[model samples]
Target chain A: GAGVSQTPSNKVTEKGKYVELRCDPISGHTALYWYRQSLGQGPEFLIYFQGTGAADDSGLPNDRFFAVRPEGSVSTLKIQRTERGDSAVYLCASSPLPGTDTQYFGPGTRLTVL
Target chain B: QQQVKQSPQSLIVQKGGIPIINCAYENTAFDYFPWYQQFPGKGPALLIAIRPDVSEKKEGRFTISFNKSAKQFSLHIMDSQPGDSATYFCAASNYGQNFVFGPGTRLSVLP
Candidate 1:
């Protein structure tokens, strides 16, 4: 039984560059979520998907931030025109269907925009 | 505006002592409350959770006291150990989006 996993543990890029962070959720979990954590702060909601479709994307800061879970199992968060303000730890979480409100989290990818 | 507010940004407690971290939310619609524990470089792990119907829920040494009337909740760790030192976050459910989390509390339990 593997837990959620994220790729590119640490990524450093210049401003205006594009970066993609991937996440693999637990097997059989039908719901996935993305969050961002800034220094000394709580994780902020980004988006969440139920199955292959995003149920909510309101938390996404702007059009430059987008995510997809085309297969309902793996997801990728895409950021365009990265800004120093976007630098943070990107977190992925998943939960079982019928909604228990408990989400299992991955180690996260730290994005640094220089 | 932040939906949830948590306090004592950080705390230090001696082994065998109890440490309490409190959180308050402005949104009354929040239905579920859960606490997460995270060590450096590690992902957050669910510790304990409570629903609005109940005033208190205890599992092991961790306890969650919910005050629906006050729109607040508190996490209490009993007989804490040095191993318990970590950052703790309290979160409230936001319908389908998972949650709105409070600013985390960093706990350092000294042995």
Candidate 2:
């Protein structure tokens, strides 16, 4: 009965360092998504995975941003050579199907590049 | 260009009053309209959602009014309670695409 969960609730790292945010989707959830939320604005989609393969990754800002949902249960959003501008709340969500299904979100991991 | 535009970045309402948040989208491809509520330190939760096929949909004190021709939709909270005070976000997306969220409205209900 556990909902979606994310680890490393808050992470502060130096610029150019690498960081990985983890997400654990609900049981039997086949679709996972990643989003980034900037202050005073809305969440911007980063990537989404259907099972093991990423179905939609066009939202990823650049090549440095990547994600993997191997085993179709847990996902990790990895950022390489983090920039100060990459500081934001990274959110993860899951749904039963690909589209039209209500997504369940996790508490999110706040990544700060200090 | 922003796909979804929401108005009144913030709102204050009385406990028994109705707080309406409106949103407009430029992409006609959007078919599913969903509203999410978020607390200060938590993730967003699905509040209510609507499709373009229906003019209006109501669930309890929450109502969603859709205008297909106008490419707009609004969420109306009737007799809002203080517990409802939080950030409300309106999102638009197709059946199998990424959602575009609005800037969000910070609702403060005074009891």
Candidate 3:
């Protein structure tokens, strides 16, 4: 009955630092996704996981950005050498089957790179 | 480039009035069109959705009108309430792929 949840509702870090944002998808969800939302813009796709393996990582901006969902349940988005441009709300969503199914989103983690 | 485009970045409507938000996409491969509502400090929640085959779909006061030929879709909220004030985002996706979302529309339903 629980919805998706993310950790560290707000995180502030210095430039060049690394930060990890975690996501806990709803129970029984098989697909997970990560996105970034900048001010006055729509959420941009980051990465996707079908199970324990990432099905799509093309949305990831660069090699500094990486994500993992080892158990196919919980996921973590890791950012290396954070830049001010990376400052935005990191969103996580999950679906029951994937594809056309409705995606449930979490509150998101606002990461600020100062 | 933005694959999906939404019109009227902001809108204000009185209670019980209809507020329509329109969206258009350039990709013909897209099949799923859904609208999401979000409030401050909250993640987006699914409001209504429609497929390309269907011309329209309605759920409660929310309706989605899809035009397969024009590659356009619109969301109409009938008899809107003050509580309806929030940001609305229109998104499109192909089968089992990540969504391409529009910039979003901010709706203000006055009481």
lDDT of each: 0.93, 0.91, 0.92
How good is the docking of model 3, as DockQ?
0.76
lDDT for position B102 in model 2: 95
Best by DockQ: 3
Runs of candidate 1 with Cα error greater than 4 angstroms are none
Candidate 1 displacement at residue B71 in angstroms: 0.7
- Name the regions of candidate 3 deviating beyond 4 angstroms: none
Identify the CAPRI category of the predicted complex in candidate 1: medium
TM-score (2 decimals) of chain A in model 2: 0.97
Question: Could you give candidate 3's per-residue lDDT for residues B1-111 as a string of tens digits?
Answer: 338999889999999999999999988888799999999999999999998999999999999999999889999999999999999999988775778889999999989
lDDT (10s digit) by residue, model 1, range B1-111 = 348899989999999999999999988778899999999887889999998999999999999999998999999999999999999999998654658998999999999
* Lowest lDDT block of 10, candidate 3 chain A: A94-103
Clashing pairs in 1: none
Rank by DockQ, highest first.
3, 2, 1
Deviation from native of the Cα of residue A75 in model 1, angstroms: 0.4
